[model samples]
Target: MKVERQKDEIVVRFSAGKNASKIQSILDYLRYEELTSKSKATQKDLDLLLKETKRGRFDKIIIEMGLDEKDYR
Candidate 1:
């Protein structure tokens, strides 16, 4: 795996036969970091949000939006 930074973006390249899922996970994290770097939210805020999400805190909002967990399941 290799990483390079361009003027406004980062590029990642991997040789063939690497684990696809792991590469995808890394790419996802890098994309998230890039997107959040321009936002005002701090790591603490993100941690709290992730904690709440894991605790089903947004279930009510999902229901209100007419989205059911069963649909996803």
Candidate 2:
């Protein structure tokens, strides 16, 4: 994954894997969540939800940070 500013819009690109669809859906939910803020969800809530985030979620974030997922190996 990588985040770059293309013209005026931000582009998020990822090197997808076999479970990319599940990862995409989780990401979509998170993006939608940030867009629709009704109540503040605390850190604890996020931590719990992280366990349920599909495979490739961690990989995407790691790549976005310019780090290899193997760092967690």
Candidate 3:
């Protein structure tokens, strides 16, 4: 395997006998990093967003199951 920096991008050259699944997982991570690199949100913002989303889903589940709100609260 060989790696080089080409302009603002990276070029990785692997011989034919590479593990495809590991390469795919690495590519997926790089794609995620690229997608979030310009984000302005903080960790606190993500935590609150996750909390609210979880609460909303739980609220929906409780209504569907006809469970008492007091039981969950």
Candidate 4:
């Protein structure tokens, strides 16, 4: 594993091999941290959002907003 800072971005490099899922989990966590750091939401708000996501509320929200997979494709 290797980490470096380039300008305003932090870069991480690693060999996935048999640990691809673990690496992806770490990356997902880091991405969440980065997003929350720049947002006004509190930890409680984030926790609630995560809980709702786990319950698939976001899928319903997408439908409410008239978004569909076909829109992306």
Where model 4 places Cα greater than 4 Å from the true spot, the runs are 42-73
TM-score of each: 0.45, 0.34, 0.71, 0.51
What local lDDT score does residue 46 receive in model 2, on the 0 to 100 scale? Answer: 86
Q: List candidate 2 segments past 4 Å from native.
A: 38-73
Candidate 3 residue lDDT tens string, 1-73: 8999999999998776659779889989999999999999999999999999999999999999999988998
Ranking by TM-score: 3, 4, 1, 2
Considering only N, C-alpha and C atoms within 3 Å, which residue pairs clash in candidate 3? none
Highest lDDT model number: 3
What is candidate 2's lDDT per residue for 8-48, written digit by digit as tens?
87787788688799878988998898786886879898887
Give the winner by TM-score.
Answer: 3
Please give the CA lDDT of all the candidate structures. Answer: 0.81, 0.80, 0.93, 0.81
Better TM-score candidate (2, 4): 4
Clashes of 2: 0
Model 4: per-residue lDDT, tens digit, 1-73?
Answer: 8999999988889975999998889889988897878788788997998997865866666778899846643
Candidate 2, 2: how far from true, in Å?
A: 2.1
Weakest lDDT window of 10 consecutive positions for candidate 1: 54-63
Between candidates 1 and 3, the one scoring higher on lDDT is: 3
